[model samples]
Target: MKIRNIFKGILIGVPIGVTLIDSLGYVARVDGISMQPALNPDQDQTDYVLLNKWAVKSYQVQRGDIIALISPKDPSLNIIKRIVGVQGDIIETIGYKNHIVRIPEGHCWVEGDHTGHSMDSNNFGPVSLGLITAKATCIVWPPSRWQFLSSSLPESRLPLNLSPPTLLYSA
Candidate 1:
């Protein structure tokens, strides 16, 4: 009878745990060298991060946020990249790279911090917002490196056209 009770607990616990993770967030290991100094800084070790699923549920994201998304070239693969351009923004890509490309509605341009080494918007074009899986909130593993990830974009990487800030009018 005790064994049966233990089995019952396992059955009930598993689904609840899965539901929480699916609705909330989960820890994921960073892979590859594409993110460089920000992520996998040392080739010998890796960083594990908390990927927040709730942040992506609304299909909204800001530039410079590191996000995990389904690979545009390969459906089976998921990749992490920084949002460089949002919908309606035009980016002037590095070194002769320009296509009359304005990020399409519901899409964003993503690229790795390492550049040249990443498989990102530069290779496959902007990714659909639907493909975004999560936003990385912090590094969870490797005790030496634990901190919240903040949104940041390099000035050189800023979009060519940004909506002008609203001006205040005094009555």
Candidate 2:
């Protein structure tokens, strides 16, 4: 009787845990040097981050936000990058085939903070919004490094063409 009850508890607990992770968020380990000073600063240690899926469920993202997405070239791989351009914004490319590019509708350009070391929009061009899975809200591990990830792009990396601000008139 106890064995049967244990099995039932396991069945109920597993699905609930999976659902929470799928819909809410989960902890993930930063795995490469592409992000450099921002993430994985040390080659020997990795940082764990809380990836908030709920925050990006509507596909709303802004410049400088760190996000994880499915790799455009390889559907099975997930890549983390910082948003550099949103829809309709123009960007000056690094080693990309084109020297300049305008983000297309429903797509955004992403890059690593480490520049040349990353395989991001520079390699695959703009990525569709659907590819985004989660936003990295904060670094949760390595006690000394715990902190929120801020959304701020380097001045030099800002988009060259941003939409002009609208002026309002009141009577």
Candidate 3:
């Protein structure tokens, strides 16, 4: 009876836990130097962030939001990046196919903070919002480095036609 109850408990508990993690959030280790200072600042240490699947479940994303998505270039891989331009925003690319691009509907431009080192939208163009799995909300590992990740896009990377932070503040 004792063994049966334990087995039953495990069966019931496993699915519930999986469902919560799938819908709520999950911890992912930051790999590579792509995100650089904002993420794995020290190559010797990897930062683990809480990726919130529920937050972007509606596909509402904005500039500066760090997101995890299925790699457009290679479906087998998942990549983490920052949202630089949302649908309808015009952006200047670093060295993408087009010098400037208008983010297409249902897609958004993403880039790594380390620029040249990242394989992001800068390399493959805007990614479909459908590909986004989650929004990175904070660092959860390496206690000394733990903190809520704040949304912040580099000034130079801001969308050209959209109001920049400076303009928004000045007006």
The CA lDDT of each predicted structure is: 0.90, 0.93, 0.93
The number of the candidate with the highest TM-score is 3
For model 2, the stretches where C-alpha displacement exceeds 4 angstroms are 163-171
User: What lDDT tens digits, residue by residue, belong to model 1 across residues 1-171?
Assistant: 999999999999999999989989999999999888899899998999999999999988999999999999999998999999999999766432566478999999999999889889888887899999999999988989899988999877888786354467967
Shift in Å, residue 97, candidate 1: 6.8
| TM-scores of all candidate predictions against the true structure | 0.90, 0.92, 0.93
Query: For model 2, what is the error of residue 156's alpha carbon versus the real structure, in angstroms, after optimal superposition?
Result: 0.6
Q: On residues 1-171, what C-alpha lDDT tens digit does candidate 3 reach at each position?
A: 999999999999999999999999999998999999999998799999999999999999999999999999999998999999999999999999999999999999999999899998878998999999999999999999989988998778889997554544643
Model 3 CA deviation exceeding 4 Å by range: 163-171
Which has the higher TM-score value, candidate number 1 or candidate number 2?
A: 2
Between prediction 1 and prediction 2, the one with superior lDDT is 2
- Specify the poorest-scoring 10-residue window by lDDT in model 2: 162-171
